[model samples]
Target: MPEIKKYLSIVALGENRDKLARDLVGAIARRGCEVNECRITPLGDHFSAAMLLAGNWSAMGKMESALPGLAEHLGLAIQFQHARPAEPQTDFRPYAAEVVAPQQPRLLGELLDFFTEQETNVVEVSSQAYDSGLTGAAMCTLHMALQVPVNHHPQTLRDAFMDVCDDLHADGLLDPIKT
Candidate 1:
Protein backbone atom coordinates (compact mmCIF):
# COMPACT_ATOMS: atom_id res chain seq x y z
CA MET A 1 0.00 0.00 0.00
CA PRO A 2 1.44 3.35 -0.96
CA GLU A 3 1.55 6.07 1.67
CA ILE A 4 -1.55 8.24 1.47
CA LYS A 5 -2.30 11.25 3.69
CA LYS A 6 -5.27 13.59 3.97
CA TYR A 7 -6.04 16.85 5.82
CA LEU A 8 -9.36 18.15 7.07
CA SER A 9 -9.78 21.78 8.09
CA ILE A 10 -12.87 23.01 9.86
CA VAL A 11 -13.61 26.62 10.74
CA ALA A 12 -15.92 26.67 13.73
CA LEU A 13 -17.31 29.71 15.46
CA GLY A 14 -19.54 29.53 18.50
CA GLU A 15 -19.97 30.38 22.18
CA ASN A 16 -18.41 27.12 23.37
CA ARG A 17 -15.11 26.74 21.56
CA ASP A 18 -13.83 23.83 23.57
CA LYS A 19 -17.07 21.92 23.42
CA LEU A 20 -17.33 22.49 19.71
CA ALA A 21 -13.78 21.31 19.11
CA ARG A 22 -14.19 18.27 21.33
CA ASP A 23 -17.42 17.31 19.67
CA LEU A 24 -15.93 17.80 16.23
CA VAL A 25 -13.01 15.58 17.07
CA GLY A 26 -15.35 12.99 18.54
CA ALA A 27 -17.36 12.87 15.36
CA ILE A 28 -14.25 12.22 13.27
CA ALA A 29 -12.92 9.60 15.64
CA ARG A 30 -16.27 7.85 15.80
CA ARG A 31 -15.85 7.22 12.10
CA GLY A 32 -12.61 5.43 12.96
CA CYS A 33 -10.45 8.27 11.64
CA GLU A 34 -7.75 10.22 13.48
CA VAL A 35 -6.86 13.90 13.34
CA ASN A 36 -3.15 14.58 12.78
CA GLU A 37 -2.63 18.31 13.24
CA CYS A 38 -5.37 20.14 15.11
CA ARG A 39 -5.48 23.93 15.13
CA ILE A 40 -7.90 26.35 16.78
CA THR A 41 -7.64 30.12 16.64
CA PRO A 42 -9.78 32.89 18.06
CA LEU A 43 -11.22 35.17 15.43
CA GLY A 44 -13.01 37.83 17.48
CA ASP A 45 -16.62 36.72 17.98
CA HIS A 46 -15.93 33.22 16.68
CA PHE A 47 -13.21 30.58 16.79
CA SER A 48 -11.63 29.07 13.68
CA ALA A 49 -10.37 25.50 13.86
CA ALA A 50 -8.39 23.62 11.20
CA MET A 51 -7.58 19.95 11.71
CA LEU A 52 -5.27 17.87 9.50
CA LEU A 53 -6.55 14.35 8.90
CA ALA A 54 -4.55 11.30 7.71
CA GLY A 55 -6.04 8.02 6.63
CA ASN A 56 -6.50 5.63 3.72
CA TRP A 57 -8.95 6.09 0.83
CA SER A 58 -11.97 4.57 2.54
CA ALA A 59 -11.50 6.44 5.80
CA MET A 60 -10.82 9.76 4.09
CA GLY A 61 -13.85 9.30 1.88
CA LYS A 62 -15.99 8.63 4.91
CA MET A 63 -14.74 11.73 6.76
CA GLU A 64 -15.37 13.94 3.74
CA SER A 65 -19.10 13.19 3.77
CA ALA A 66 -19.63 13.26 7.54
CA LEU A 67 -17.63 16.40 8.42
CA PRO A 68 -19.97 18.87 6.76
CA GLY A 69 -22.88 17.83 8.93
CA LEU A 70 -20.64 18.00 11.96
CA ALA A 71 -19.65 21.53 11.02
CA GLU A 72 -23.25 22.59 10.50
CA HIS A 73 -24.07 21.31 13.95
CA LEU A 74 -21.34 23.51 15.40
CA GLY A 75 -22.40 26.46 13.27
CA LEU A 76 -19.11 26.69 11.41
CA ALA A 77 -17.55 26.23 7.98
CA ILE A 78 -15.96 22.89 7.18
CA GLN A 79 -13.16 22.20 4.68
CA PHE A 80 -11.43 18.87 4.12
CA GLN A 81 -9.28 17.05 1.53
CA HIS A 82 -6.85 14.19 1.13
CA ALA A 83 -3.24 15.30 0.68
CA ARG A 84 -2.31 15.44 -2.97
CA PRO A 85 0.90 14.00 -4.56
CA ALA A 86 0.17 10.89 -2.55
CA GLU A 87 2.75 9.17 -0.32
CA PRO A 88 6.39 8.94 -1.37
CA GLN A 89 8.18 5.77 -2.46
CA THR A 90 9.83 5.22 0.91
CA ASP A 91 8.57 4.01 4.26
CA PHE A 92 8.69 6.95 6.59
CA ARG A 93 9.54 6.26 10.19
CA PRO A 94 6.23 7.01 11.83
CA TYR A 95 5.92 7.85 15.51
CA ALA A 96 2.42 7.96 16.85
CA ALA A 97 1.74 10.53 19.61
CA GLU A 98 -0.98 11.10 22.17
CA VAL A 99 -1.50 14.40 23.98
CA VAL A 100 -4.19 15.54 26.38
CA ALA A 101 -5.21 19.14 26.76
CA PRO A 102 -7.72 20.60 29.17
CA GLN A 103 -7.29 24.20 28.02
CA GLN A 104 -8.92 23.40 24.65
CA PRO A 105 -8.15 26.08 22.06
CA ARG A 106 -4.68 26.69 23.40
CA LEU A 107 -3.90 23.08 22.66
CA LEU A 108 -4.22 23.63 18.94
CA GLY A 109 -1.84 26.59 19.00
CA GLU A 110 0.62 24.63 21.10
CA LEU A 111 0.56 21.69 18.67
CA LEU A 112 1.41 23.88 15.69
CA ASP A 113 4.18 25.73 17.52
CA PHE A 114 5.90 22.54 18.63
CA PHE A 115 6.07 21.07 15.10
CA THR A 116 7.53 24.26 13.64
CA GLU A 117 10.21 24.44 16.29
CA GLN A 118 11.11 20.75 16.04
CA GLU A 119 12.35 21.01 12.44
CA THR A 120 9.80 18.39 11.53
CA ASN A 121 7.12 18.95 8.95
CA VAL A 122 3.71 17.42 9.55
CA VAL A 123 3.61 14.56 7.04
CA GLU A 124 0.20 13.29 8.16
CA VAL A 125 -1.85 14.85 10.95
CA SER A 126 -5.17 13.64 12.35
CA SER A 127 -7.00 13.91 15.66
CA GLN A 128 -9.87 12.52 17.74
CA ALA A 129 -11.48 13.48 21.06
CA TYR A 130 -11.89 11.41 24.19
CA ASP A 131 -14.05 12.60 27.09
CA SER A 132 -14.25 16.26 28.13
CA GLY A 133 -10.57 16.81 27.55
CA LEU A 134 -9.24 16.61 23.98
CA THR A 135 -7.19 13.60 22.94
CA GLY A 136 -5.15 14.25 19.77
CA ALA A 137 -2.85 11.84 17.99
CA ALA A 138 -0.44 12.91 15.27
CA MET A 139 1.92 10.82 13.19
CA CYS A 140 5.44 12.23 12.72
CA THR A 141 6.73 10.65 9.56
CA LEU A 142 9.84 12.08 7.92
CA HIS A 143 10.55 12.28 4.22
CA MET A 144 13.90 10.57 3.85
CA ALA A 145 14.68 11.88 0.37
CA LEU A 146 14.85 15.44 1.65
CA GLN A 147 18.13 17.29 1.92
CA VAL A 148 17.48 18.45 5.47
CA PRO A 149 20.25 17.85 7.98
CA VAL A 150 18.08 16.55 10.77
CA ASN A 151 17.90 12.76 10.61
CA HIS A 152 14.52 11.35 11.61
CA HIS A 153 14.14 9.72 15.02
CA PRO A 154 11.70 9.30 17.91
CA GLN A 155 13.52 11.78 20.18
CA THR A 156 12.99 14.54 17.65
CA LEU A 157 9.23 14.02 17.89
CA ARG A 158 9.21 13.40 21.65
CA ASP A 159 11.11 16.63 22.16
CA ALA A 160 8.50 18.51 20.20
CA PHE A 161 5.65 16.96 22.15
CA MET A 162 7.35 17.60 25.48
CA ASP A 163 7.98 21.21 24.59
CA VAL A 164 4.32 21.73 23.78
CA CYS A 165 3.28 19.88 26.91
CA ASP A 166 5.53 22.05 29.03
CA ASP A 167 4.28 25.25 27.48
CA LEU A 168 0.67 24.14 27.78
CA HIS A 169 1.26 23.12 31.40
CA ALA A 170 2.84 26.45 32.21
CA ASP A 171 -0.19 28.16 30.76
CA GLY A 172 -2.53 25.90 32.79
CA LEU A 173 -3.74 24.09 29.69
CA LEU A 174 -2.53 20.70 30.80
CA ASP A 175 -3.42 19.09 34.12
CA PRO A 176 -1.29 16.72 36.14
CA ILE A 177 -1.99 13.25 34.93
CA LYS A 178 -4.09 11.11 37.25
CA THR A 179 -2.29 8.04 38.44
Candidate 2:
Protein backbone atom coordinates (compact mmCIF):
# COMPACT_ATOMS: atom_id res chain seq x y z
CA MET A 1 0.00 0.00 0.00
CA PRO A 2 1.15 3.54 -0.75
CA GLU A 3 1.95 5.76 2.18
CA ILE A 4 -0.67 8.35 3.09
CA LYS A 5 0.38 11.79 4.31
CA LYS A 6 -1.71 14.80 5.27
CA TYR A 7 -1.13 18.17 6.89
CA LEU A 8 -3.08 21.13 8.25
CA SER A 9 -2.11 24.81 8.39
CA ILE A 10 -4.15 26.77 10.87
CA VAL A 11 -4.25 30.45 11.87
CA ALA A 12 -6.45 31.72 14.63
CA LEU A 13 -7.01 34.91 16.59
CA GLY A 14 -8.81 35.41 19.87
CA GLU A 15 -8.99 37.52 23.00
CA ASN A 16 -8.23 34.64 25.32
CA ARG A 17 -4.86 33.72 23.85
CA ASP A 18 -3.54 31.38 26.48
CA LYS A 19 -6.74 29.47 27.02
CA LEU A 20 -7.37 29.17 23.30
CA ALA A 21 -3.90 27.72 22.63
CA ARG A 22 -4.08 25.26 25.49
CA ASP A 23 -7.51 24.03 24.55
CA LEU A 24 -6.83 23.82 20.82
CA VAL A 25 -3.61 21.85 21.22
CA GLY A 26 -5.22 19.54 23.71
CA ALA A 27 -8.19 18.97 21.44
CA ILE A 28 -6.01 18.11 18.45
CA ALA A 29 -3.70 15.81 20.36
CA ARG A 30 -6.65 14.03 21.92
CA ARG A 31 -7.83 13.26 18.41
CA GLY A 32 -4.44 11.70 17.54
CA CYS A 33 -3.09 14.44 15.28
CA GLU A 34 0.55 15.54 15.58
CA VAL A 35 1.07 19.25 16.04
CA ASN A 36 4.27 19.77 14.07
CA GLU A 37 4.71 23.54 14.22
CA CYS A 38 2.99 26.10 16.41
CA ARG A 39 3.64 29.82 16.93
CA ILE A 40 1.50 31.90 19.19
CA THR A 41 1.67 35.68 19.48
CA PRO A 42 -0.14 37.95 21.90
CA LEU A 43 -1.32 41.05 20.07
CA GLY A 44 -2.00 43.20 23.13
CA ASP A 45 -5.81 43.08 23.11
CA HIS A 46 -5.79 39.95 20.95
CA PHE A 47 -3.79 36.81 20.27
CA SER A 48 -2.82 35.10 17.03
CA ALA A 49 -1.56 31.62 16.39
CA ALA A 50 -0.24 29.63 13.45
CA MET A 51 0.04 25.87 13.63
CA LEU A 52 0.88 22.99 11.34
CA LEU A 53 -0.48 19.53 11.98
CA ALA A 54 0.12 16.12 10.46
CA GLY A 55 -2.67 13.57 10.43
CA ASN A 56 -4.75 11.33 8.23
CA TRP A 57 -7.53 12.60 5.97
CA SER A 58 -10.26 11.42 8.30
CA ALA A 59 -8.65 13.17 11.23
CA MET A 60 -8.46 16.35 9.19
CA GLY A 61 -12.13 16.14 8.28
CA LYS A 62 -13.05 16.00 11.95
CA MET A 63 -10.90 19.01 12.72
CA GLU A 64 -12.28 20.95 9.78
CA SER A 65 -15.74 20.80 11.28
CA ALA A 66 -14.90 20.83 14.97
CA LEU A 67 -12.49 23.76 14.91
CA PRO A 68 -14.96 26.32 13.60
CA GLY A 69 -17.51 25.49 16.25
CA LEU A 70 -14.89 25.46 18.97
CA ALA A 71 -13.50 28.84 17.93
CA GLU A 72 -16.93 30.37 17.61
CA HIS A 73 -17.78 29.19 21.09
CA LEU A 74 -14.62 30.93 22.30
CA GLY A 75 -15.21 34.08 20.24
CA LEU A 76 -12.21 33.60 17.97
CA ALA A 77 -11.57 33.84 14.24
CA ILE A 78 -10.04 30.79 12.59
CA GLN A 79 -8.65 29.87 9.21
CA PHE A 80 -7.15 26.60 8.04
CA GLN A 81 -6.02 24.83 4.91
CA HIS A 82 -4.40 21.59 3.87
CA ALA A 83 -0.63 22.04 3.89
CA ARG A 84 2.16 20.69 1.73
CA PRO A 85 5.04 18.69 3.11
CA ALA A 86 7.93 20.74 4.46
CA GLU A 87 11.24 21.04 2.67
CA PRO A 88 14.19 19.06 3.98
CA GLN A 89 16.59 20.86 6.31
CA THR A 90 19.93 21.87 4.92
CA ASP A 91 23.30 21.81 6.69
CA PHE A 92 23.59 25.35 8.02
CA ARG A 93 24.45 27.40 11.05
CA PRO A 94 21.51 28.87 12.93
CA TYR A 95 21.49 32.34 14.43
CA ALA A 96 19.08 34.51 16.40
CA ALA A 97 18.86 38.29 16.34
CA GLU A 98 16.76 41.24 17.37
CA VAL A 99 16.46 44.65 15.79
CA VAL A 100 14.99 47.85 17.22
CA ALA A 101 14.41 51.16 15.48
CA PRO A 102 12.03 54.02 14.91
CA GLN A 103 8.88 52.85 13.20
CA GLN A 104 8.78 53.51 9.48
CA PRO A 105 7.69 51.89 6.24
CA ARG A 106 10.11 49.81 4.10
CA LEU A 107 12.45 48.89 6.97
CA LEU A 108 11.40 45.22 6.93
CA GLY A 109 11.43 45.02 3.16
CA GLU A 110 14.98 46.29 2.99
CA LEU A 111 16.12 43.91 5.69
CA LEU A 112 14.47 40.98 3.89
CA ASP A 113 16.20 41.86 0.65
CA PHE A 114 19.52 42.12 2.43
CA PHE A 115 19.12 38.66 3.89
CA THR A 116 18.26 37.27 0.48
CA GLU A 117 21.37 38.80 -1.05
CA GLN A 118 23.43 37.36 1.80
CA GLU A 119 21.99 33.89 1.09
CA THR A 120 20.36 33.65 4.49
CA ASN A 121 17.13 31.77 5.11
CA VAL A 122 14.84 33.25 7.72
CA VAL A 123 13.32 30.52 9.85
CA GLU A 124 11.00 32.75 11.86
CA VAL A 125 10.23 36.44 12.21
CA SER A 126 8.12 38.48 14.58
CA SER A 127 7.76 42.23 14.55
CA GLN A 128 5.74 44.80 16.43
CA ALA A 129 5.25 48.54 16.57
CA TYR A 130 4.53 50.48 19.70
CA ASP A 131 4.71 53.93 21.18
CA SER A 132 7.61 54.75 23.44
CA GLY A 133 5.52 56.11 26.28
CA LEU A 134 8.35 58.10 27.78
CA THR A 135 9.56 59.69 24.54
CA GLY A 136 6.23 59.57 22.77
CA ALA A 137 8.13 58.24 19.76
CA ALA A 138 7.06 55.28 17.66
CA MET A 139 9.32 52.24 17.82
CA CYS A 140 9.55 48.97 15.89
CA THR A 141 11.10 45.80 17.18
CA LEU A 142 11.93 42.68 15.18
CA HIS A 143 13.02 39.26 16.35
CA MET A 144 14.20 36.61 13.92
CA ALA A 145 15.82 33.22 13.57
CA LEU A 146 18.06 32.73 10.56
CA GLN A 147 20.01 29.92 8.93
CA VAL A 148 23.34 30.77 7.34
CA PRO A 149 25.05 28.14 5.25
CA VAL A 150 28.48 26.87 6.39
CA ASN A 151 30.07 28.25 3.24
CA HIS A 152 29.63 31.82 4.45
CA HIS A 153 31.97 33.44 6.95
CA PRO A 154 30.12 34.13 10.21
CA GLN A 155 31.92 37.41 10.86
CA THR A 156 31.23 38.56 7.30
CA LEU A 157 27.54 37.81 7.67
CA ARG A 158 27.40 39.62 11.00
CA ASP A 159 29.17 42.65 9.60
CA ALA A 160 26.81 42.87 6.62
CA PHE A 161 23.79 42.61 8.88
CA MET A 162 25.13 45.31 11.16
CA ASP A 163 25.76 47.50 8.15
CA VAL A 164 22.18 47.19 7.05
CA CYS A 165 20.97 47.94 10.53
CA ASP A 166 23.21 51.00 10.61
CA ASP A 167 21.70 52.25 7.37
CA LEU A 168 18.25 51.85 8.84
CA HIS A 169 19.39 53.53 12.05
CA ALA A 170 18.33 50.37 13.86
CA ASP A 171 20.21 48.51 16.55
CA GLY A 172 20.75 44.77 16.09
CA LEU A 173 22.58 41.85 17.58
CA LEU A 174 23.18 38.36 16.15
CA ASP A 175 24.26 35.29 18.05
CA PRO A 176 24.67 31.58 17.29
CA ILE A 177 21.82 29.28 18.23
CA LYS A 178 22.90 27.02 21.08
CA THR A 179 22.21 23.37 20.49
Candidate 3:
Protein backbone atom coordinates (compact mmCIF):
# COMPACT_ATOMS: atom_id res chain seq x y z
CA MET A 1 0.00 0.00 0.00
CA PRO A 2 1.17 3.53 -0.74
CA GLU A 3 1.99 5.71 2.25
CA ILE A 4 -0.46 8.51 2.83
CA LYS A 5 0.98 11.99 2.69
CA LYS A 6 0.42 14.52 5.46
CA TYR A 7 0.23 18.28 5.08
CA LEU A 8 0.89 21.35 7.19
CA SER A 9 -0.29 24.92 6.65
CA ILE A 10 1.93 27.52 8.25
CA VAL A 11 1.82 31.30 8.54
CA ALA A 12 4.76 33.24 9.89
CA LEU A 13 5.33 36.92 10.58
CA GLY A 14 8.51 38.71 11.57
CA GLU A 15 10.66 41.75 10.98
CA ASN A 16 12.01 41.69 7.47
CA ARG A 17 15.41 40.07 7.17
CA ASP A 18 17.47 38.95 4.22
CA LYS A 19 17.87 35.40 5.49
CA LEU A 20 14.36 34.70 6.75
CA ALA A 21 13.18 32.81 3.66
CA ARG A 22 16.35 30.80 3.43
CA ASP A 23 16.25 29.93 7.11
CA LEU A 24 12.62 28.92 7.03
CA VAL A 25 12.95 26.75 3.91
CA GLY A 26 16.15 25.19 5.25
CA ALA A 27 14.43 24.30 8.48
CA ILE A 28 11.61 22.59 6.64
CA ALA A 29 14.07 20.70 4.44
CA ARG A 30 16.13 19.62 7.43
CA ARG A 31 12.97 18.13 8.90
CA GLY A 32 12.36 16.13 5.67
CA CYS A 33 9.33 18.15 4.67
CA GLU A 34 8.78 19.61 1.17
CA VAL A 35 7.27 22.99 0.49
CA ASN A 36 4.40 22.48 -1.90
CA GLU A 37 3.27 26.10 -2.13
CA CYS A 38 4.36 29.30 -0.44
CA ARG A 39 3.93 33.05 -0.57
CA ILE A 40 6.38 35.37 1.13
CA THR A 41 6.05 39.12 0.98
CA PRO A 42 7.54 42.13 2.66
CA LEU A 43 4.75 44.28 4.04
CA GLY A 44 5.89 47.69 5.24
CA ASP A 45 8.51 46.97 7.90
CA HIS A 46 7.41 43.38 8.47
CA PHE A 47 7.70 40.09 6.63
CA SER A 48 4.83 37.68 6.15
CA ALA A 49 4.76 34.15 4.78
CA ALA A 50 2.26 31.42 4.25
CA MET A 51 3.32 27.94 3.22
CA LEU A 52 1.91 24.52 2.55
CA LEU A 53 4.23 21.66 3.41
CA ALA A 54 3.99 17.98 2.51
CA GLY A 55 5.57 14.95 4.13
CA ASN A 56 4.96 11.55 5.58
CA TRP A 57 3.56 11.21 9.08
CA SER A 58 6.91 10.99 10.80
CA ALA A 59 8.31 13.96 8.93
CA MET A 60 5.21 15.95 9.73
CA GLY A 61 5.71 15.17 13.41
CA LYS A 62 9.32 16.30 13.17
CA MET A 63 8.27 19.62 11.62
CA GLU A 64 5.65 20.20 14.30
CA SER A 65 8.23 19.59 17.03
CA ALA A 66 10.96 21.77 15.52
CA LEU A 67 8.86 24.74 14.41
CA PRO A 68 8.51 26.42 17.81
CA GLY A 69 12.21 26.55 18.60
CA LEU A 70 13.03 27.72 15.09
CA ALA A 71 10.38 30.44 15.29
CA GLU A 72 11.81 31.72 18.56
CA HIS A 73 15.32 31.76 17.20
CA LEU A 74 14.20 33.70 14.15
CA GLY A 75 12.10 36.13 16.20
CA LEU A 76 9.09 35.17 14.16
CA ALA A 77 5.54 34.59 15.28
CA ILE A 78 4.28 31.37 13.68
CA GLN A 79 1.07 29.43 13.49
CA PHE A 80 0.45 26.07 11.85
CA GLN A 81 -2.33 23.57 11.34
CA HIS A 82 -2.97 20.29 9.60
CA ALA A 83 -4.35 20.82 6.12
CA ARG A 84 -5.51 18.96 3.02
CA PRO A 85 -5.01 19.89 -0.60
CA ALA A 86 -7.92 21.61 -2.30
CA GLU A 87 -10.07 19.34 -4.36
CA PRO A 88 -10.56 20.15 -8.04
CA GLN A 89 -13.80 21.94 -8.83
CA THR A 90 -15.27 20.86 -12.16
CA ASP A 91 -18.34 23.07 -12.00
CA PHE A 92 -16.38 26.31 -11.77
CA ARG A 93 -14.21 28.21 -14.20
CA PRO A 94 -11.08 30.15 -13.33
CA TYR A 95 -11.19 33.90 -13.90
CA ALA A 96 -9.22 36.99 -13.03
CA ALA A 97 -10.61 40.26 -11.68
CA GLU A 98 -8.81 43.57 -11.55
CA VAL A 99 -10.00 46.85 -10.08
CA VAL A 100 -8.28 50.23 -10.00
CA ALA A 101 -9.69 53.30 -8.34
CA PRO A 102 -9.13 56.19 -5.98
CA GLN A 103 -8.45 54.74 -2.56
CA GLN A 104 -11.36 55.01 -0.19
CA PRO A 105 -12.52 53.44 3.03
CA ARG A 106 -14.45 50.20 2.52
CA LEU A 107 -13.42 49.83 -1.13
CA LEU A 108 -11.94 46.41 -0.60
CA GLY A 109 -14.81 45.40 1.63
CA GLU A 110 -17.36 46.40 -0.99
CA LEU A 111 -15.59 44.43 -3.72
CA LEU A 112 -15.39 41.37 -1.50
CA ASP A 113 -19.07 41.72 -0.73
CA PHE A 114 -19.85 41.69 -4.46
CA PHE A 115 -17.97 38.44 -4.92
CA THR A 116 -19.76 36.93 -1.94
CA GLU A 117 -23.13 37.90 -3.29
CA GLN A 118 -22.29 36.42 -6.67
CA GLU A 119 -21.21 33.14 -5.03
CA THR A 120 -17.79 33.40 -6.67
CA ASN A 121 -15.00 31.80 -4.70
CA VAL A 122 -11.92 33.96 -4.32
CA VAL A 123 -8.84 31.78 -4.68
CA GLU A 124 -6.22 34.46 -4.22
CA VAL A 125 -6.11 38.25 -3.83
CA SER A 126 -3.48 40.98 -3.73
CA SER A 127 -3.84 44.71 -3.48
CA GLN A 128 -1.62 47.77 -3.46
CA ALA A 129 -2.16 51.38 -2.48
CA TYR A 130 -0.25 54.26 -3.97
CA ASP A 131 -0.51 57.85 -5.11
CA SER A 132 -1.22 58.62 -8.76
CA GLY A 133 1.78 60.46 -10.11
CA LEU A 134 -0.27 62.46 -12.60
CA THR A 135 -3.13 63.49 -10.31
CA GLY A 136 -1.48 63.32 -6.89
CA ALA A 137 -4.52 61.36 -5.71
CA ALA A 138 -4.47 58.26 -3.51
CA MET A 139 -5.20 55.19 -5.57
CA CYS A 140 -5.58 51.46 -5.02
CA THR A 141 -5.39 48.48 -7.35
CA LEU A 142 -6.67 45.00 -6.58
CA HIS A 143 -6.28 41.70 -8.37
CA MET A 144 -8.08 38.48 -7.59
CA ALA A 145 -8.20 34.95 -8.91
CA LEU A 146 -11.69 33.58 -8.75
CA GLN A 147 -13.49 30.33 -9.30
CA VAL A 148 -16.73 31.44 -10.90
CA PRO A 149 -19.70 29.11 -11.07
CA VAL A 150 -20.39 27.75 -14.54
CA ASN A 151 -24.09 28.50 -14.22
CA HIS A 152 -23.52 32.24 -14.49
CA HIS A 153 -23.41 33.68 -17.98
CA PRO A 154 -20.03 35.27 -18.65
CA GLN A 155 -21.33 38.35 -20.40
CA THR A 156 -23.95 38.91 -17.73
CA LEU A 157 -21.35 38.68 -15.01
CA ARG A 158 -19.09 41.12 -16.82
CA ASP A 159 -21.93 43.57 -17.23
CA ALA A 160 -22.85 43.39 -13.58
CA PHE A 161 -19.20 43.85 -12.63
CA MET A 162 -18.98 46.93 -14.81
CA ASP A 163 -22.13 48.34 -13.23
CA VAL A 164 -20.63 47.89 -9.80
CA CYS A 165 -17.44 49.57 -10.93
CA ASP A 166 -19.44 52.52 -12.26
CA ASP A 167 -21.19 52.88 -8.91
CA LEU A 168 -17.80 52.87 -7.15
CA HIS A 169 -16.20 55.22 -9.68
CA ALA A 170 -13.59 52.57 -10.45
CA ASP A 171 -12.18 50.93 -13.56
CA GLY A 172 -12.44 47.16 -13.52
CA LEU A 173 -12.12 44.14 -15.74
CA LEU A 174 -13.14 40.49 -15.43
CA ASP A 175 -11.79 37.90 -17.81
CA PRO A 176 -11.14 34.20 -17.97
CA ILE A 177 -7.68 33.26 -16.80
CA LYS A 178 -5.48 31.97 -19.57
CA THR A 179 -3.44 28.95 -18.69
Report the candidate with higher TM-score, 2 versus 3: 3
What TM-score quantifies how close candidate 2 is to the native fold? Answer: 0.82
Question: On residues 1-179, what C-alpha lDDT tens digit does candidate 2 reach at each position?
Answer: 86586899999888864477778788888766889888887888888889998888888888887887878876779899989767766778889879999998988898889888988898888999999989989999999889888898989989999999999999999899997
TM-score of 3: 0.97
lDDT of 3 by residue, 46-136 (tens): 9999999999999999999998999999889999999999899999999999999999888888889998999999999999999999999
Kindly indicate the candidate among 2 and 3 with the higher lDDT: 3
Which regions of candidate 3 are displaced past 4 Å? none
Score every model by TM-score: 0.42, 0.82, 0.97
- Scored by lDDT, model 1 comes in at 0.55
- Write model 1 residue lDDT over 21-131, tens digit each, in one string: 677778888876787766775656577676677676677788878867776787777765555434643433334344544435556556655656655445444444345
Q: Which ten residues in a row have the lowest lDDT in candidate 3?
A: 104-113
Q: Of the candidates numbered 1 and 2, which has the greater TM-score value?
A: 2
Backbone clash count, each prediction separately: 6, 0, 0
